[model samples]
Target: MLPDQSITEELPKDRKQKRQPHSAYLRRRLMTLTSIIIVSMFALEAAVTAWYDYRAQLANLEKEAYLLADAQRSVLAAAVWNFDFDIINNAVNNLFSMPEIMQVAIRYPDGEVIASAGKLSDGAAQMRITRPLLWDQGGEKEIGTLNVVIDISQVESSMLVKLTERSVTLSATLFICLAAIYLACRWMTQPLEELTAAITRLADGDLEQRIPHTQRNDEIGNVARALVKFSENSRLLYDLQNSLTFNVAEKTRQLKQVREDSAHDNTVRARLLAMVSQEIRSPMTAIQGAVMLCKNGLTGEIQEKTLHMLHVAERNCERMQKLIEVLFDIYQIQNHSLVLTLSPVNLLKLARTQTEIWRNKAYQTSKNLHFESGVAEAWVRGDEKRLQQIIDILLSNAVRHSGKGGEISVHLRREGALISLSVSDNGPGIPKKIRPYLFEGLARSDEACSDSLGSGFSLTLAKGLVELQGGQIYFESIAKEISSNSTLPTGATFYLELPYIPAPEAAD
Candidate 1:
């Protein structure tokens, strides 16, 4: 499999897989929540209403009973004072005739029965009462009782009739309110249903869908606005994706044409490389032979300056070969053809080695190169070549950006299962306009590229390679006022954090 296949894979588009509309979900959830609240409120109100009405009925009954008792008291007192038994019986009969006064009775002092009226008819029972009277007997005042009977059923029936009528009316009123509530819920839910249907259509590739507008500025209005935004965003994203796909397809066609042209170009380039290698190698070999012969004094004693010139040429040739190797590796990495023979690598050691190699170069430029580690060993499973390439790229960037006599700091720290390698330089930071695309190909700061420079593909290629090996790269550049370094107006820091793996044991 290609090294970058996983990174570039596009997820499939399935409209049917969309979630239910937020408005519908919101409406349903709101409706349920409202129902729960309303029911709870009404239930509490009903319990209180029932208790208050019952207490009022009891109070009314007690008041009416007291009034009846008082009226009966006067009649009995008049009859006793006049000593007219017939008049008392007649008054008692008259009181029982009243529909609410179901029964009446009276008793004289010394427990003798005086008079009685009415009967326990229709399952009604009589309620009993008493009054105290004083009578002289011998030398002491004696106690006697005047008994009265009132029908409790009479009071109960009257109060119950009134309460029943009120309850019937109240039940009808409650039913009407509940019916209205249900209808209002249905009417409100209609708009939500309409919004849901429109959104469903939109999800099914109907970008032209829209919700009906309302003058009401409630939650419904908010929902309408959100749905409209969602539809517009979906349409815009759909159009943008199509535009991108079309551009990609067109570029692919052009690339195919370029590939055909590049085939012939590659043949020419190969021939040119072979010829150049031969031309360069032939001279270089001849010069080496001549130098050996001259050292041996085959022709004559060579001057010190001439011998030194030959040595410089040989050194340049060796440097050119190493540069060619780097170029080939970069090409393979760009084409996504480089296969990594991944193994556990100790990152601390890698950083130490790269720091040592670049320290000399930094010294040559009158800059300080510093390497510090918070860990003795940090291991990762990755391609050694690619990892080395990343370290070199970061170090080279730091070295190039660091001012003369400035400092470049390379720090490695282990955080859990990952290792963090950060390279920071005391140099002018990236510009705001360029920071967004800083890692893209062929992008460079003017100051750093003034001296000997390579193609501006290293950072981009390094980022891609690190990501391919399950690592990430990020950068931060602080402003001059905020930064402690006075030599730089601003400075940039790059971080590469890679997952760590333990090293394999040597064969026993």
Candidate 2:
């Protein structure tokens, strides 16, 4: 018959369908602020009222003392002139009867008591002279004197009653005013409280929650409208952001697939080229051996011209094979999937030989190719073939890019533990914008097109080969503005620094 306990616990929302009113919350907040303000005002008002009451009591006592002095002058004059003790005694008795009169005494200028009525000590005039006293006679000659001691009890009592009445009225009025302020504050803040709750829900990811805008020409109405606009804009921006993220993710996935396919193609091409090179070089090698045997005339004499032709053909064929092998090596290096063939080499000699090889090409281009070395000998521990490739690539680049009738210089120096080799040419310099990506393989710029050897592959492969041998390569190029003269042609300079090994003889 009854629902389960867990279901019942969760079912309270159905019974209390109505949400809590914003007015109730606002009323509580206003009451708290109003209570603080009322308490502060009441404290200030009480302090001021008590001060005023104390001052009024002091003034009343002063006024009464002066009136008693005037009354004493008349009564004492009549008693002395008429020689009637009854009049003087009756006047003193009346003064004593007054509640403000604590004590009264009549004294001569010489401190002699002529008459006294009320409680006082034998020498009370001297002891009780803290409050100012008045004399009956105003002149310097004091034939007789009268003194009145005014009591302040009645004035204090009356002032207390007045202050108490004022306190009750002031308290009642302040309470009423605070109550009115509390009601007004609650009314003004009710809509704002509801709007805040709605905004809170929206901030917590509930886009559907929104403040209701009531039409009225007031700040509260304007704020409600502005909030509704903000909610709409936020919803649109959220959806747009999600769509952009999805689009970017999809594009990134496609780019990854393209890279994979390109990688696969490169692998297939490399394998096919390797097979073709092997097949071609084998027959060319056999022909060269046969040609060499005929040139030697083992069986018959051969013409000198025919022998010269065979030598040229063999050399050209070898060059082509070497180019193919270099391409294959570069690809393998890029894939990080190749092992280097390491050997110790005399780097200075290697560089000299490569420079001589490029001298003819540089001459044909009308550029002077020169090689200078300060090192007597420098040994390097690295792959001889790879290191030579790096040197050849740099030389070939210098020869190809140098201006006509320009100088191309190659310098090798054994500077401390480093073997520093530099190849610089006089030509149009490399552009600054493309300099950063110059060593990156397959990175080509329009300015590089000026050179016939500008495949953008040589520097990339050279850098890799040098690094594989535990060396570094960087280049610097001077601008045309710096090298203005045609003879001093602006060009790029490639600096190669490699670790040098101690010679076997030197070590011993």
Candidate 3:
């Protein structure tokens, strides 16, 4: 309802809307999941192909090596039988001509090397094949052994190149798959994203937003349909709430206008009362003077009955004059026309003076009035007249509320940089229901009290005057049970606090 309060209520929604959308999360997860699956499949395929191809190549190379060794066995056998060193050398040299053959050796039947070509080193990447040479075809005649060492490093190098190519292809494939998945996810969730945006706008007070894909027959379209329904409902609800709010606001505005009119009327009445009281007081003052003279025999010798009547007329005039002054003070406070003449005044002296005046009045009412001052002289910055009025109001309330034989206490003390004054009464305390409106003009706890007499305007004027002089007034009350029969003793204490100002130091 309040501007600041409305902003506070809407701030969390604003912050939540500012966060990343669900579509972004969906897109990222889809792309990542797709890429991982594709890459894993490619890696597995590459690994299986490479392993199978390497094993097949190794088997083929072994078979070819055995064939080459068999073919060279006959030549090597005939060469060794003839004891022809040139033939053995030629055969071995021809075997070395094969690039795969790293070494070749023809040995005699007695284990003596007849001929050898190329170097033979023991390395894991080489394949070796050996075959025994036969001299007679029908009979087994041992000649020599043909040994050939083939280099497998070239095969391994070729396989490594193939694997590198596959790796490059796999990487490219993964990139393509990622791009496709991203596009696919974007297409699938695009409607949802739009719906979300529309919802966000609606939540942000844009009730006109609508989902655009409600006609499609898919899951997204189903959601869109539901969202459209929600939007319609929300719009209707918003309209209803808006209408209610407008009505309430209209009523509130009317109520405020009425209150303002009432305040204006009260102000006009106070001004009128001030004017009438002044006019009546002038004549009443003259009448009182004449009556007092008649009672004193200054005009003529008056009878006892006439003198008693004069006395009654003078007292009535005094009461009327006091009521008029109170009305004038209320008018001044209501119009904000009460001006304070601020000066350094001794609050202790002011409290003592008002206490002595109220003490006599309390005594006449059979109420005990006591004053306690913690400090001899407590200086404060305030208007003396306003301060006196505050004390008077508190004392009057205490004496009026406190029953006969009740005790009323006034305490004044200097508390740090402030002066505290309190008036307490051992009588019925303020009722809880009336505490809220206690300081309002013409508001009285006792409804039967005459408006022209104890209208509670004094306390309101006192609070206004105190605040105008940079002071505060408040009260505390406690209800205590006195006996098994009596309900409780309602007692109240009113406190006034004003800034303490020390006297100016004398110049040296």
C-alpha RMSD for every candidate: 15.5, 11.0, 9.7
- Cα lDDT of all candidates, in order? 0.70, 0.71, 0.79
Global lDDT of model 2 = 0.71
lDDT of 3 at 99: 80
The best-first sequence of candidates by lDDT reads 3, 2, 1
| Candidate No. with top TM-score | 2
Tell me how far the alpha carbon of residue 172 in candidate 1 is from the true structure, in angstroms, after superposition: 36
lDDT of 2 at 408: 91
Per-residue lDDT, model 2, residue 446, is: 60
- TM-score per prediction, in order, is 0.41, 0.65, 0.63
Query: Candidate 2: where are CA atoms >4 Å away?
Result: 1-65, 71-88, 97-102, 107-115, 119-147, 269-273, 277-283, 287-309, 335-350, 353-369, 374-385, 392-409, 413-461, 470-505
* Candidate that scores best on lDDT: 3
lDDT of 3 by residue, 70-131 (tens): 77677778777788789788878877888888888887667787778888666648987878
Model 1, stretches more than 4 Å misplaced?
1-327, 479-489, 503-506
- Which sequence of candidate numbers ranks them by TM-score, best first? 2, 3, 1
Kindly give the stretch of ten consecutive residues in candidate 1 with the minimal lDDT sum. Answer: 6-15
lDDT of 2 at 72: 65
Superior candidate under lDDT, 2 versus 3: 3
Worst 10 residues of 2 by lDDT: 124-133
Candidate 1, residues 1-508: lDDT per residue as tens digits?
2323322331112112433235644575576567656766765666566657656765654466556656766656666656778877776776666564555656565566667776656666555555554443454332334444555664466556656665676567667666866777787778878878887887788878657643334556556666665666676778889999999999999999999999878666545544554556656567667656765668887788877876776666554554444445455555567688888888888889999999999999999999999987888888887899899989988888878888899999988888999999878766666677877655677776654244355676788789889999989986444555555457889999999787678889
